[model samples]
Target: MNFAFTEEQQMFRDMFADFVAKEVEPLAEHISEHEEIPKALLKKAAMQGFLGALLPEEYGGAALDMVSYILLLEEVAKSDMSTAMVLHVHNDLVSRAILLCGSAEQKEQWLPAMAEGSVIGAWAFAEPDPAGLTNLQVMARAADDGYVLHGTKTWVSNAGIAGLMVVFAQAPEGPTALLVPADAAGLKLGQRDKTLGMRGVQIHPVYFNDVAVPADAVLGRPGDAQAVMAAVGDFSRLAMAAIALGGAEHALSLGVDFAKERKQFGVEIARKGAIQAYIADSAVEVETLRSQVYRCASLADQGLLDGLSASIAKLWANRVSYQVANRMIQTHGGYGYILDYAIGRVFRDCRTVEGIEGSNRTQQAAIARSVLAAHGFVM
Candidate 1:
């Protein structure tokens, strides 16, 4: 089967690459050092149609296909993973959830603004529970006319900056999601989290204390939160895998360039057997990840729900990213560990993929369950 991108897709990828090189790469060092997300950069991305890549055209989005979205994600990730993450959270998790589950009016109200970047969306799901099973905990209770939300969401990206949030909470009926206004009363945005990687995307804790939202705030039916979350989870895992693949590809490219230029014992490092082996191994890993990501994306685009494939791609891609980045760092020796070098930041960023969007261990269990079910195994 032909795996090459279409002409239009190629053009889209090139355009995104140019945008990242011109707008994001220059600010990467400053963002990493200060842990600041450049709001203007996000606005620029919105204006350029990057924020709405997957939304329908009626909602002001380009409504590009999933492969095109993946291409754009990869290009953005290659420059600044943090900035790429901001777009990913907005597009894949928040906006996609609304599109997939919200009522028609809800879509009309939120999708256009979200696509225009006037309303940024954040996903609030992760918590500090050691078990990491916050989905089963009821944090908000539905009242007669509205819901009283009470809970704390940790590691929430764009918590303070986003205009809207899709908060997963437990309701009296069951697990549910509420679309909360960022400026809602009784809602608090905690101080920025100091993470080792993806610093340009602000991570914060969100506290909802007696925050009231109308009945219409519910996304889909009550007790359908798990379904909505599962869909989001699948898309997010695959998208994150694509991002990791992009980072690994970037790391490989840099390693190759550096090896070709750096000389040792009066010969270029690229010519050495060890360096050559490292490059070869990294290339293999990156290519494999690319294939897995594309296959997952294709399946999603076709409306084929393959949780197993999504988990496999996410698990493998995350591990491959860490391996590729670590090897690249080793190849660069002392220089790779320094802040001045981009590999150091990429290395840290790569580590985050395995943990976020569900950990590799979680993916493994999910995959195992899928295998058992296919084989008619009953627990």
Candidate 2:
């Protein structure tokens, strides 16, 4: 199987890279310090067709394949993780979920506007509960005309700014998902969180108090929340792996540039045996992680939900990113600790990968279970 990108894909990557370098990189320091991604930037991305890279053309998207989508994400992440966070949550997770699972009417109603960036989508998951444990304790309830949603979803990316939300809730039938308008009655956005990294994305808690959604707002079949969640988890794992790979590449590049320039003991640091060893090890790990991520992406594009592959990719990429960023920091010496340099911010962003989407321990368990199942073990 050929792993090379087509000319169109290469062009897409180059164009997007240039866009990020001009539009995103210049604002990275401001976003990291201020903790807010400018709304105008998101609008600009939308106008550039960056927000709908995965949706079908009928829905106003670029109709790009999974490889192109992942490539766009990696490019954006390489420059500013916060902007990538917004795009990932909005386009990859929420928009893709709607496209895959929404009814024909639902798609017609939501996708076009969302594709144009007139409507922003946010995924509501990740409660305070520990990883891999399903807690059917949502306060949302369905009644006569519609479902009454009441709960607090924390660590929600694009919470306050998004125009729509795909909310997962527990009901008597089973866990259900609902598409809620951001302006829906009784929905309230809490204060923005000050996270360790990925700033400017506006993570926050959304409180729903007796918020009513139309009966048609439910996504997919009833009692299929677990399945929807599993699908989302799979997509998230692959996307996060892509992001981690990009961040690792960024850190490795910075380290190489820094080592070649900095003088130590009357010579360039790049000439030092120890620094060369660090660069070699980081390059090897980054390439390995990139291959694994691409494998998972290819499998997913083929509609193969290979849970073990996804989990392994996510686990390895996350760990590799952390190691690479830390080493980059070490190579930069005192300069790495300063906020003006991108290495420190990249380091913090890399650390967040191990915990989000699903923790490393959870991914390990999933992989183990898949292995046992493949070997004919049950339960």
Candidate 3:
């Protein structure tokens, strides 16, 4: 398959890189320490259409193809994983769902504001049970006028700041997807989660206490949560894999620069065989991951992306990122443990993506299932 980026894609990558280098990289340390992305930086990103990278042009979006969209996320990740995740949740999980499943009226009502970034989107799916859709604790009871939602959604990304949320809950008919405004009465956001990394993501537990939404608030059809979630999950895994790839590349660069400057004995550490091997191994893995990420994006564009491919890419990316980050830390020696070093942050951020869309165990199970099915082994 052709992996070469088109001229347009290259141009988009350059634009994204320029923006991240100027506005994101400089603030990466500040964001991690403050546990917040500056509102001004987010607004500037919105103005550049990065927030609307996947929506159609009619809705004021860039309408980027999947590869170009991947490029955007990858570039942002090289600077700040937190900002990349914000864009990922907005475009991949929330806006894309609205564009794909919402009725024309729903689209008209939400898409433009979402594209313009006046309305940011968040996903509310994970619950305490962690069994996924089949065992969602959140319930949407049908009422004469509409539905009243009751339950708590945990680990909601972009929680407090999101203008809109796509929540999944159990209905009488089974699992269902609904659109709820963040300001709806009885919808409360808990204190922000103090995560191990990716501090700027703004995750929180969302409480829905007798929250009411119109009958039309259902996304797509009732009892269609499984299908909607599966689609969104596949794309999110791929997007996350791209993020891991970018983070790995950035870590490698930092390690290489340090090794070249760090003096050992009478010469630089770059002259050492061990340092050379670390750099070479990391470079190889980074290139391999780049291929996997772009191939999956191309598959998505061709409507040929499958659960197996996405799972593999995500699992591999997570593994490679963590490994590369660890090796780079070793290369940095004591400096790697210091907060002043960028590798420390990169290492922390790499750990967080492993559990974002689907945990490493989740991906492993998915890969096993696919393999067994292919081998004609029925569970």
Candidate 4:
């Protein structure tokens, strides 16, 4: 029940904070404005073990625990949710996917480059169809050598720059996940999508037009959707929590700073009752989410957390983050709404985290399912 971070974890947090202060914060606007992550920063982040925090030391990765990874994600997201989104995709969705479900052979083949940042990865879990099917819609038919993939995935984060992608598909064996290289023949990327937020992070609809890959490309046992999803859901939810918490904390900090500096009636806004209440609420909310995040992350590190816990953490944190960010913007008065200030970006960025890793609505359904199962309901 001790939620205090270990001294080592605190030190790691401080180190990452320094890195973010110097490298990431300066480039947040640049990335958000251009929808691009600088190549050099990517290299530096890899060197800092962000890209492959879960990979074992044998593969040139830091092999960080779930708690430490959460800390890193939180610090980075505070500066730029877009860059944070990219890191989460590469680390949690891609690298972590392989480590959790990847075959030993597959790990050997790809984990090194992934850990070194020489290769970036994406995980495509959604379909492009208008019907909104959550299941893998891409079809992979067995060919003479391996398989031919035919389908498209929309709003795939990290697709634009990913050197490799873990694509889920309907294979002959059933729902399967394949490790498809970016340059595979017949693979086509749709135009970069103009997203409302996270515009700096490239996303698109990826088309697998008879894209082919060898049998070894399979990440794990094909058709074991339950196994793959069980692993994916937990970390995805935790990662989203980290992203949201970071934004919330940063927005709250921004509001506090602005309050102290802005004055009305010859008194600092910090002394005003209304502005102080906003800060008070935001401060409390940030701590509340922080407690949930660390508690769940600790449980995950101990292997005591279930998918239900992850979903609940994400559901609550995402909602709270938006609330906190919105309040901070309100506290800033007219200045917050302007693009020149960072709070406006934080407002939009938090909204995007709410939708990803399955939307807040999706998490509600998942949490309900868990409740039913706990209550002895069976299908």
TM-score of each: 0.96, 0.96, 0.98, 0.96
Candidate 3: clashing pairs of residues: none
Give the clashing pairs for model 1.
Answer: none
TM-score of the candidate numbered 3?
A: 0.98
The weakest ten consecutive residues by lDDT in model 4 span: 128-137
Q: Which pairs of residues collide in model 4? A: 35-200
Error of 4 at 244 (Å): 0.5
How high is the lDDT of residue 374 in model 4?
88
Greater lDDT among 2 and 3 belongs to 3
Clash numbers, per candidate: 0, 0, 0, 1
**Which candidate comes out best when scored by TM-score?**
3
**Best-matching candidate per lDDT:** 3
- Candidate 4 lDDT (Cα, 0 to 1): 0.86
lDDT of 2 by residue, 1-379 (tens): 8788789888988988999998888888788888998878888898888888788899999888777778888898887887887888888788888888889998899888888898888888766662322564455576897678877787888886798998888765677888999999999988888889887778888888889988788888765777667666787788888888888898999999999999988899999898898899999999999888877777777888577888898899878989999999999999999877889998988888886777788888888898898899966
Candidate 3's residue-wise lDDT over 1-379, tens digit each? 5768999999999999999999999999999999989999999999999888899999889989999999999999998899999999999999999988899999999999988888999999989777768888899999987789999999999996799999999988889999999999999998889998899889999999999989899998898898788767788899999999889998999999999999978799999999999999999999999998999999999988899999999999999999999999999999999998999999999888897877789899999999999999977
Kindly list the per-residue Cα lDDT of model 1 for residues 1-379, writing each as its tens digit.
6677789878888888889899988888888888876878888999998888899899999898888899888888887788888889999999999999999999999999999899988998876673333354427776889788987888899886799999888787777888999999999988889888887888899888889988899998876787788767887888899889888988888888888888889999999899989999999889889998987787777887478898999989878999999899988888997788888998888888886887878888888988998999855
Q: Which ten residues in a row have the lowest lDDT in candidate 1?
A: 129-138
lDDT of each: 0.85, 0.84, 0.91, 0.86
